[model samples]
Target: MKDSTQGTSPGPGTPLPDSILIVGGGVFGLSTALALAARHSGKITLVESSPTIPNPHGSSIDTSRIVRADYAKAAYATLAESALEKWRNTDWGREGRYTQSGLVLVSSGDQFGKDYVRESYENVKAINPDAVEALPTRRDVERAAPGYGSGLHVSGGYVNWGSGWADAEASVAFARKKVEETGRVNFRTGDVKRVISEDTGSAAAAARRKVTGVELADNTIITADLVILATGAWTGRLVDLRGRAEATGQALAYIRISDEEQAKLANMPTVLNLSTGMFIIPPRNNLLKIARHAYGYRNPQRVPSPADSGSNPTQTRETTIEVSLPEKDVPIPQEGEDACRVALKEMLPAFADRPFVKTRVCWYTDTPKGDFIITHHPQYNGLFLATGGSGHGFKFLPVLGDKVVDAIQGRLVPELQKLWAWPESPPAAAPPPPSSSSPDTVVWTEDGSRSGPKGMILMDELAKGGWKRSSSKL
Candidate 1:
């Protein structure tokens, strides 16, 4: 087999058409494009109007985050295991674990969360028996890390040798680097106002109805055979998001713990306080990250309808971008911050005297069941959906990427069968792209083909320069 890290090669048949298009540059979108490019060399193009990884509106970025395989289901567990192996063994850049800080999940004795924790522990142990241990009581939490409050501990806890925190930004950049090396994936700066699907009938239709290309606000049509929308917060409006968008919203809080306070939580595993809906991630560079995993209630219908984006240019159109609305701008409540502070102090009194050093808001695209909705849209034949991650989706991204790639390739990923499925009936036709979407820019093609290594370098320069002009507002 060809080296997976190397750029893709033209497959059998009329040298697989040289063009493939991707809509979002967030980690998922970029990673998918990278994976495909590494496997099949083609003219790959990724459109992202966001200046960087977090996409001012992106949900992928965080100061520090955890990655582990503690899941109630086998598929999710397996996916996480894959990601863990990749991060640990691959030089995807920055190492993704805190060797010293253990990861912990706590729930009340009678709560439903106990099952989740217990299942997660048992599942992880099944994969690597020698490395996992269970701590059944709050007393165990205190005993494992003295001075820790019994209040924070609960019915169960588990420590696994392989799981821990990683620098989110670095991990993303590392993946981005791989995308660039493939030479096929090119990152371009432009807001997509239209996704044009050619109307072709038959297996030959794959070649005919392939994405004719996208129309930007500038009105230039960039053509491609396949399109993937990975735009984070803006995805719902840009595409037919189904029910996932309605449940998504932004969250924020400031962690006031100090080095001294962290010392108390140090060597401590990442804490999931189910009772409070709060998680106190271990401190990174002297700061603690705290937030709740409560249900989100943002208006998903706010995203502009694509029909409106593709229709009459002279007409005025409204987009359901709630985060930017003045009314929705009412800040994430201070009470949320206060609650986090008090919880930290309650669990580790050492934090009682310190104040938060920094704070910012982020989003969680949620689903009603509190689990992820990784389904496919019925309207768009080749389009695949991977939203509705809810709050705890980050740790599973690498594995999730694999599932997404499988879906994109039209494979039946069993692990995703439960969490992801296409709707039974045909989806109503999507509205044309809204007029407010970005106007198209002139499409640029590679002057010539180069070996994988040379193509990879060229692609990186294009993405860096192409995406530099993107907005911070996303």
Candidate 2:
């Protein structure tokens, strides 16, 4: 975390090691591969757990994800604006992949919610004055998007026509095709058992571990000069990110709407309520989606302590640690369904009683400040991390790789270098790490954009099942 921000062009790759292995084929992984293949001549291999490029279980493979430059943080807002340009001007946004349906961010009068909406208005207005409108009351919000029920639980908000949503699956497929055209990257499929490492010194005595490669679940080993761990939510299985990052499940439900209903709401702006952590995008293809963007549920599982990550490790070798991993291809639990159902009642009274045709528990790799971890391990050489999407990484799909490559080569801009670097100390928003050897801690993100229930366990909620339907589709 040196002063890499000064005197560096945040440009393309700089010919990394002769062999580079990127783990996971999701947003961060595929995008990184596409960028690397374009700039580097060395051998580059991309490995994925799923045979297909758009893994159905991945968080990035959803129907739609918000793409907005309306962020309270100026840095992310500016970066998102740059990405919006690509989604608007380049082929990256073609073929129904990107839709500028606009977005209205409303809040329920809480201090944090109000402050977040207010600052986001200021930032996005500065970025695009033509499409910005400030709604200072609930009536004003209803006026901005008449499709939304007039009885919304918001005090004030703003609408940014500059923002939009992206087709997550299509964009990932597009990225994969782009990488394949390069013909410089080798693709492999395997579930990584663990990252293999070698250390000159003992586990103690301040030893530095070098990751040679990864060992697959079938015991197949692949060696490389550099290994980029962009495994998204599953990164904790290969690295000890107890306090820094972990997987949290967010709830979403899709309902069937008639053609007439779809036409009426299809082009309406997306509405997100910060206080309740709920939102709804316009219906498409006779399907409407509602989701909660809150502090999500954690599904804790016992896993072997991952690599040291050059960070200090107190645990002895060959030990098991319980961390939150993804419960893929599973339906969201009763509590989440209830939350979404209640929000539907408030936001769209017409669809409040309709049964959800599908429900999903999308997982997010959350960090304390919602900042992505995209730098070399502070303690391990040849081990780089590009994860911690925290539910907002999809919009950056167009340009995430270029920035990642820049950071890899130490040419990233000064501002981004500071934001993406490995934390020297525990973040203020991060829960305090467990004092004992037990790695039991809750990661409550206080980035001011999240709300709703906290500390709900995934299994516990599923056990108390009360779905409108007997079985829910994945």
Candidate 3:
């Protein structure tokens, strides 16, 4: 792999072609579109399957997402640090969109020897010593945030005052507005069927193909000089990622905090249990968002539509029924609810009995090592990919678009180039076959014992060991 610092290969240069089409208007697509519109004098068109820019099912679309630079890896830590700078300086940071409440990391053991929390603390400290502060014991953690060390055994950890949270959905909307004002970028709402390609000759026939543009579900064929697949989670449905990525749906729950509890926990920072991959966002609008950062459940039944079927390949249709809307029919599964409950009970017991105002099965396009893929297609010319958020991409919202632009221009730094490059071959363990039942008909389950919306138990019903019907709103 070539070093990205050497800059993109000598070719068309940073100036993009006149017509550029981006499929999937999530974080990756919008950010890249905005960057391109600012840099290149061209008409950039973005196709979003959903009705709006921030597709409600997109990993980028959410109420609140953590923004922290305490990464176990130095490269990501550096990127996050740069992203934080932009978050604080840009409009996205101001206007009450970003909250710098700091971040707390809790570990089950000492701050050394293979502990993720310790590694993160050490890495962040390496960048800026003052940015990280050690909490030597559970008492130290509780002292920093009252009742934070209640049920959990917090041996030691650290707090990065530089970290905080962002309103993800709002941030995306703001970016969309900025790009729209430029007039160079046009937002088109429709499901992309597939990348329209053409065979040039015998040389291009055997191996290489040129992507001309994309065809929509309505059979509207829009041509372009370049086509970028920024479809998060649904990338596999559009292109063969060679087992590099797969969509895994993780669980997220919003617990309604009482006025008293909200006031008491108002100052609490975003808390992360590095060992368990569980984290809690600060209270906002009387709701506390709790989620996990693990390899979540694969939707075994929701298979991607065949590319030749003339159907939307972005999985937008399935997502709309499964998650895009606030419909009460979407089930979060008992396992998801229990996972949040267990983590919260151990970390913040006071809020364990709070009612779950809402629950969601957020999806992520996961990679094996959690590194993002931001390279061009090996077999198809004029085709590029910017997917693979791997659950942690939201935090890098401020600067991720520029990186994608760098990737498109082949100007990625050496470290990032090697990290984001496509693998020569697929992994040893083959990815599961892309076959599943219909997303609408499939039943969500927890350990395969019980299923349906009822399995997503309410907090008040947890003690009774039975389902308790409740409204799905605060």
Please, what is the TM-score per model?
0.74, 0.92, 0.83
Q: What is the lDDT of residue 114 in candidate 2?
A: 80
TM-score computed on alpha carbons, candidate 1: 0.74
Candidate 2 lDDT over 1-474, as tens digits, reads: 122223457354454888999999999999899889887889999999999989888988878999999888888888888889999999999999999999999988764578888889988888789999999898999998999877698888999998989888899999999999989999999999888777646655355678789999999999999999999999989987877888999999999999999999989999998888899988768989999989888878888777454344444577777888888667888788888889888889999999999998899999888999999987777889999999999999988998888888887887887888887765444333343232345577778998876677777778777433224342
**Poorest 10 consecutive residues by lDDT, candidate 1:** 442-451
Candidate 3 residue runs with Cα over 4 Å from true position: 1-15, 110-114, 147-149, 301-329, 430-474
Model 2, total clashes: 3
Q: If the candidates were sorted by their TM-score against the true structure, best first, what order would they fall in?
A: 2, 3, 1
Residue 330, model 1, lDDT: 27
Q: Which prediction has the highest TM-score against the true structure?
A: 2
Model 3 TM-score (2 dp): 0.83
**What lDDT does model 1 reach?**
0.55
Residue-pair clashes per prediction, in order, are 30, 3, 4
Candidate 1's residue-wise lDDT over 1-474, tens digit each? 111221212333223345667777766676677667765666778888765754544566666666777776666676677777766666642464323355666676675466667777878888877777777777776665454566664666776766777777666666677678767777887878777765456666433333466788778787876566666555655554443343333334555555776676656766665555566666666676766654322321244555433222223355443221111222344444565676667566666556665545455554434345454455454444555555556666554565565565545344455556644532343332353221121011111100011111111222444423132233
Point out the higher-scoring one by TM-score: 1 or 3.
Answer: 3
Tell me how far candidate 3 lies from the true structure as C-alpha RMSD in angstroms.
7.2
